[model samples]
Target: MRITEPYTIFLRRLPSGKSVYYYQFRDEDGKRSPAYSTGTNKIAQARRVCQRLYNEGKFKKSNEILFKTFASGFFDDESDFCKWKEVNGSSLAKSTIASYKRLLENQILPFFGSMKLKKINTDTVKRWIVWCSEKCSAKTSNNAQSVFNIIMKSAKEKKLISEVPSSELAFRKIKKKERELLTVEELNRIYHSPLWGWECARRAFLTCAITGMRIGEITGLQTFEVGDDRLNVEHTLHPKFGLGPTKTRVCRFVPIPKSLGLKRQCGKTWAFEKPTEEKPCRADYIYGKLMLICDSLGIDHKARGITVHSLRNMFISYMRGSSFGETIDLKIKAVVGHADESMTDWYTYWKPEMFPEIYEIQEKLFKEITEV
Candidate 1:
């Protein structure tokens, strides 16, 4: 009945009157190994020996579990493994969990699932990478490898392995593609066009273009978060995950122009409420309107891979191209909530009133979009 990590220990006596501790271990599947003696008469000494052997990976039977069995329900939100991960302070977002599950089910599990946990080594991983390279893009192979690393680390935590085999492995290089950004002239074309309908979609697109907010951030923006000449970006609306913290999980204050006229309706909380609807505008609807506007103006949006997210690119590029020079560097990062910036608190201090230059630039941009 005595239980310890990696093994359950019990005492047994021989005919010669000497007592020794026997230990039994279980695999990831909960199948127990046969009892083996610790050859120690003292329980305290026996427990230490058991721990030492466990640390050294002497419980070979536990490592015999198949990789697929070991990874079962690992990415499932309700699984014991996932719950354990949360309790251990590594809780993942719902969207992240879903992505891990996709990688596991589609890539990692299929390659290593039949192999024993002990059999997965550097050679095996390299072979899997080779197989993945032939079957998918480098980006997908890279993601699959990352998910594989997580599983192996979890196995190491459970003492199933002494170390993660993929630790020294290198990922495939990914080719970076530049995201398309709309030009100032193009923005003017869309805004000034009488053909453009969908008032909510246009407002949201304008907000994104001016502030570099992601489509999700634009949708999640509330009336209360809007100030006289600034918007507090505290949340993002995911179609699948609904309302969540900003992508960086850090709130940012983006300077806006009062001329943009973003306001809350009497019964609406969303800054960009859809016509009579109480909910925020859908990202797809906004994207559709953008593409249509581009088509009516003879802009090849599809050829240039323009999407709603392109507005963010447009905002960053426009700010960088502006005459303000280096003074506006940190302000752009803060407005976009760049996760890697360590001076987020410092950047947040650039309030709309304090930095009239930002409003000046935004007002100029707004005038271009609204005026002929």
Candidate 2:
């Protein structure tokens, strides 16, 4: 039996012999919502919830806002959502905001842009998920799904929707591919080669190889942070956000051989500044030089997925497996600023002189590369 005057209530029975109460209510425009769960088995409680929500005008509120219009101001500093996040002490970085905006424009808005927030439901979101799988890689599809959920959750928090559409399905799984890392011989070749005339980028790549600095860290490295035998890492350069905190937001001091010949200045001048300009060189520029060197040396750069980041991977692998760095995994993590909370105490009390093996390892590793 169905009660159809003010609203309709029904019980859906599961195979396990449990019944759930669901309801459908009409809006001001006479549009009925998809059956929403009251999350109770008791019909009396379900009726009270439905009546209370309808009286509060939640049934009519969702009709006025379009998904695209609401999403347009999602991360803007002036938006209520941004203010709410700030008040709660969870403000997102500009780079993260930019990434979310790209996902909205490219993946989300194309399908949901014209749809009403009220009309977005589980089936609709599932269809979008299938579409994303067909169009994007598994990882990228997952990112799109995550961003959409965040938007729906925000809408629900603001009372724009009764509840966020549940994508209860698991995100698509990505098959992990083994990234190609530079070998000792290949590294020696790269170190000795001219790097297609990109001297500064070559230095940056070598720094990452020996000290395990990320390309972004190299881009943001300041002259004052360098010392006679070690460099302090405090910030990283985002392509769009410029200088900001490192990826893990943890600062580290890494030992480097003085033979690397990195010079220190008084203030915050970039250590890897372009010769022609005072600005830090682009990561893409460094990557391009690496690709060019790989080509010139007959290395399978593209087929093997080699890139500038391979330098850091090489460093980590060598340090973790080498005899000198065998028992110092925690120190290795501290040196590279790996994000592990269990090692926080070790990272806190770190000093360059505390780990003499790393200096010896550095000296042996860079001895060939630094020699003329």
Q: List clash counts for every candidate, in order.
A: 0, 0
**Candidate 2 structure quality by residue, lDDT tens digits, 1-372:** 954555788999878898999999887777787887776799999898788666645566476667886786677775556777779966776787788888999999998998889998999988998988888899988888889989988888867888888547678889987877778778778877865475777778778789888898888888888887888999888888888877776677888887777874323477887877778867888888888888889999878878777777778888888896568887888888887775565447887778887887878788755555
RMSD of 2: 11.7
Which regions of candidate 1 are displaced past 4 Å? 1-60, 84-90, 264-267, 343-354
The lowest-lDDT stretch of 10 consecutive residues in candidate 2 is 260-269
Q: Which pairs in model 1 have colliding backbones?
A: none
How many steric clashes does model 2 contain? 0
Tens digit of lDDT per residue, candidate 1, span 64-114?
667877787678765556777779966666777888899898988888988
lDDT of each: 0.80, 0.80
Candidate 2 is scored at a TM of 0.74
TM-score of each: 0.79, 0.74
